[model samples]
Target chain A: MLPTQLSALLADPAPGVPEALDLVSSFDQGLVDGLARVSPSAFGGLVDAFAGSPLRDRVAEAADKIAAGSISDEHLFVLAGARSALFGAVHDALLGQADAALGRTRASWPGGSGDAATAANLLAGSRSWLRELAITGWRGVDHDLVTAAGQTIEAALAEPRLRRLATLLDGLAAELRACSPIATMDRLPVRRWGDLWSRAMLLAQDGGRLTPSEPVTGRLLVLGADVHEHATAVQIQVHGILETPGTAPRLVRTSVAAPKVDTIVGPAVWRLFAAHPVLLGALAERLTLDVTDLPLLDSGDLLWSDARAKAGPPADPFATARVLLAGAAAPAVPPLERHPARISEPVFVEGYTAVDGAFTLGDRTIAVDTTRLPSCGPLTPQLVAASHACIGLLRWDDGGWSLQPIAVLTMVKRQPVGVHTTDWALGPTDPKVVKAAAAAGDAVAVLRERAGRLLRK
Target chain B: MDVERRSVAPIIPPVKPRKLAKVPFVELADGRLQGVVSSGSDVERVYVSSIGAGSHGLSCSTNNNRPCGGLRGSYPCKHLQALLDEAVLQYGADRVARYLRIDVEEGRSLTAGLRAHHEPSPAATVFSSFLRHLAYLELPDTTAPVPELHWFPSVGAAH
Candidate 1:
């Protein structure tokens, strides 16, 4: 229902200047509040209705002065209606500019045919659309849309015909600011942004060991591995994830360097993997070699050649050398006992019994000669298995007495587990040594190819 | 809205090298020779041209180092000469020559849009050179002023 004074004015349709100003004065908050609700066509009609009216011109002038801070303590009720009417003028000017440019180009120019419709239609949307976009920004940032609109308007401003669009955009920016309590239209609360990553969990460490929890899922995007190094260790800090799309993406990490993994995989290898995670992932997918055999440094010449053929040049030549040297077979040399030195004094050496021999000590059955003294008895396979130790005179050492311990020498016996490269048993389980080297080689090859492509272009 | 694409045509002629001083000359990628030469006013005119797509205008103004048409060649136009020298060195003589040929073949347009920016100075020269380089990079700007200058793999070395 219209106000009684406004209904009276509408019935007459063409009020005198004094009467028109009095009728507009009746609306204070209502005029400013309803500005966003008016339809573009209806706003256009109002602009046309007040065309060349001195009262309308005075109102627009007074609004401008208020904005410029030249007028203060003025009657805002009249000014608010003027501001609402001012939006109508802005709408008309923008439409005219777009129409003029479209007519000139016939909808084809720098961006070509399809873009003509997009550019014009975006500007032609209702004034309410801009307000709606501002409101959206208030709740949560739609940065891509905001940036596109801003850029489109900026580009339009360069064209002489579309110059007025800038003024309209400035006004819309103000309206958007008004829609929000926050001073900046783009600033938004964290929880308001839907689909943006808002939660994080870190791996915990206990007793010098890294304890891993389950990886976070759902709305997952990218996981960035940041590699940093100290003197003795290299750390791989995973830098969370990017959860939302924007012109300028903002990555939110709730924790700083959390759930870190430390490895002595060498700086070169870590650097290679960390520098180009995407390239490494791509290469890993394409690789036909066993992941267990990765970082193929310890492999012989045959494996090296095969890796080079598959992955291109090694990324870090030094790391490759270290792997190769560490993996090479031992040099061919006889034991020290076989060497011709003077008949040495009695030497004591520790060893496991290999075969049946005389002289059983404890539960050990040592295989060595003890027939020279009565302390030993004849050795048999059963007795030797039962015996734990024995003494013998070694012929290999010029009759020096030797003692052998039959400590459990079974192949099934357990050995200490460690990350040490020299630990033979580790070869089957831990794969860091191999993966690091292979990744380094692949990274070098990929980076070189990328650089080459860019240079040629 | 009634607008049409501006038509473009070549308006300026090749530079007159003789009007220039007997200074050392460096030939640019676009078939134009840049050198310090004396004009009829006895001032040394820095002879620079936007040669490819034809000459954008070849009247030698004094280089940035000196007042316009000053007498001394001692203050050579470093901006024009240095940038050209660097370009020639970085992108070999053959590549630059190839670029020149491409520009020459693509005759200049006379359209208002094709008209060189009003501030026709060393700054403009650098900007035009940059645009040509972007074309070399295969940037997708069909509306770029000098599309003919765009690099093509088959177009000699610069391509």
Candidate 2:
């Protein structure tokens, strides 16, 4: 149970993270029991204490609405919203502290010294944890848990071994005055794969600009293609990186829409393309073209038009592509601007092991988000194990960073081989595609046959 | 390029299935082990059950507030047991045990440590969550863009 002193602190007009933490930590089983039995209206002042918070108003309105009635769905949602807002405020404050500490440590140690690097890595880890807490709205957290987290950060800030890193410990005393919460009520609505794809399509529609018709030529390396099965259409989006010498590589994509058909089964990538000869040829030309001035959208979408094409020197583009990808730096995006299925930045990640459905890069393990992938045909453990690197989008979704691999690179008999992970959806003629399809078994043929018989009737 | 030339070693082994649907929704939130459980007899019926973690104050009632007959007993009802089992499945056994503040040595079961008595908690909140979960299935498979997703970083020049 909260001591009288701590309980008194809860009445403060604006409580800082420290005060909030203390109040939450003081909640024992008996205190929590008491809280559950009481009406939400009894704690209306607590809600009002977060002055100017939109959630506070909403919660107040909800409490009043339910004052003379039984609890309803709105009450539950409002309660969750209130909890999220309160917890989010605290997490955001902690993140600000961590960010400030990082800035100080970096400033003091300009040189890439060992201590500086270790401190930076530790701070980065701490930031990641705090960011995740903010994303999850600190759900299921209790007082003891919050205290342990606070103490750990406190100790890290005061550690004598890293004196330079510890300089920001005094800043921790600064009161977090703002209680504004990023409204999370919208997140309560469960979203599915279709919803995400629709969102991507919507974003793709607006604010796109066409490049000058004067034509800029570059070597286009077709990385891969993803086939999306929607209700009305089978949409195939092909991805590639355009390299103009002395310019930064630009990620580009093109889409092909085909009528929905039920006869094609078992890995639509191979079956669909195999049946569509003309579409297959166009895809082949895109892959074979050495240089082309394709009309392009600023969003990296390629537009079909009177584009020039030429065959240049026969050399592997994968090596140069890897070198370009290594130097690519993604622009920093704030947390609020991130979401699931949003491809904020496209880059290549090399030197990682795929294990346990995640990629281990150095000391950090990022889960492989298959949902964002256009298609999962070539992402089998066998292919992943053989690959040395992958090119994909860096996305912040489900409360953390995930990579959606579009292409995979491997060494076969000492030759660097790059295959579009989505190309398995292309023509089954490709030996790699044939091999993958074979491994998937005769189920494909059986399904195709069944589908064919059904169509014939 | 043919990847078959090289010997393919399996990287990710098949995952062990931890099906958590014995009880549809269980969460450690609001200082309680609470969720809505499907009725054993009626497919359409559900009971909202919650046990305050350390207080062991139990509540089992239908969405409309009718108390369960099982609440008369000192021990948790079958629905609560199912909730605990699913909670262990959702969050690991250790986390569930720790949240409930129950003492259990290594390899001992969590339910063995639980104790409960009747103390009715409002069932509306958990029932609402279950309804929301069901609502996801009713949503149409749509190709049209969703307005709610606009907050995501724009992939175009607008950003």
Candidate 3:
């Protein structure tokens, strides 16, 4: 049962208000109850701070009796507000003098539990601060409250555990250090499974002029764990290119580019090469082993390469293919095939340490050996791969990181480009001149010149 | 077991091809199999030769702050070494090392397992800074907190 003055103070919501007016409001009932409930009997240690204090008379008077049964919102507000005021002062004390204020906050109270009393006192200032920040957004807020809170902790010596408790609360309240007022939390990234994060940062090296050959210079943000304990996880996302407001760009429809080298090769050929990855590695000139993973950009016809229920690969494509189960290799692939499969030449780029095998194209073994690809700078494996992928991932509609194989039969039928032999295929740019001519939108000249370069190179 | 002798079985310890991804910086430049790992970050750059039957593999730590504890001379410690060991079971030794740049040797070498945690090198600092740049941007560009191993391109240094 709060008296009328406190009740009246709580009822008013607006107009020129005093600093203490915030203490006794509808906003903090717990604060008021906590302050009013403080008792020295509950806490044993320090009996000095309030023994002759001015607050003693007020507590004594409030203890006489409950004049009314129902506790009005206004009454609760006053009690809360008063508690808030005390806590605010205590808060200021702690900020001004940490150790001294700690002692006073622990001093024994005449009422209830010492812990409860401490919590109540702290809650007073805490609630006030919360309201002040909430109501005025901390503008014109008193720094004195924080200082006053520090003064109440005078009894921390023998009751050391109490100090720890007080510190714990304070720490939680302000655990995150503020570098900037705008910065509120320190985020630590956590993932259920270990995986590398991929980020794309676009920076120019030469000039604003996009390379005529490598229009897209995509970089690989490769994050992998050290060992088997760490299965290399990969993620790719687009960065830099932002949509501009107004002036909608004209839409163009085109087929998606198969992953990096989505060359179309027959299934039988693909299997033959898969078994002989070293052979393809040799042909691709990668010189790799089995564990190396490759992305495939497939011809659209083979919508689902792996006939499995799930999108991922099957446990064993070879054995499962004949099992009539999903993800088994299709009948198109066999143990051995007269026709060897083929992948794009870019597979010979740097990090591609493995390939199926070298295929004989005329007197030359058309194995694009990446045996000498550098690993750093502008033309290293990383650099070349980045450049190729960048172009693949960003070139018009047929851009992205993908690796798929299509049947040679399908490629011949579609005739995206000329394929004289089943052994090799060519893109818009193969021989240098053809690539150059193609860039100029002159496909016929480029193709003819590229065919000659192919013979020469 | 290529029972037929053509060797199509993908034998348990398949024949390993040369791992070009193992940046041959120290080995190629100074022609040294031995190198120092100043920061735990450069562990992955190490290339261990003669792993299984003369085939090589690499190992690196994912735990950057933990100091990638059990490395012999290579960057990744024993824990990561074991993880790579199984990679041979999946991707075959040579090809896997090429993609990951980390290898799993068939047989463990007592000498290759030495810890290079203490010794510092300028190349290592450069490698560490490289990693820091990636991390500071909070961009997931490279593998996370690569362990005791450091990667330096063999040719990049030469150039």
Using lDDT as the measure, which candidate wins? Answer: 2
Off by over 4 Å in 3: A1-457, B1-123, B126-159
Estimate, for each residue in B1-159, the C-alpha lDDT of model 3 and write its tens digit. 112111011112211212212221111111112222222244332312222212233333222222334645545454444434433433354433333333345685432433323332233332332232222122112211111010100111112
DockQ of each: 0.01, 0.03, 0.03
Residue B97 lDDT in candidate 2: 74
TM-scores for all candidates?
0.16, 0.38, 0.16
Give a tens-digit lDDT track for model 3, residues A276-296. Answer: 222222222211112111221
Q: How well is candidate 1 docked (DockQ)?
A: 0.01
Off by over 4 Å in 2: A1-215, A245-247, A262-293, A305-317, A328-340, A370-377, A410-419, A429-457, B1-159
Assess candidate 1 and give its lDDT.
Answer: 0.25
DockQ-better candidate, 1 vs 2: 2
Interface-residue RMSD per candidate?
36.0, 18.9, 25.9
The better candidate by TM-score, 1 or 2, is: 2
Candidate 1, residue A434: lDDT:
49
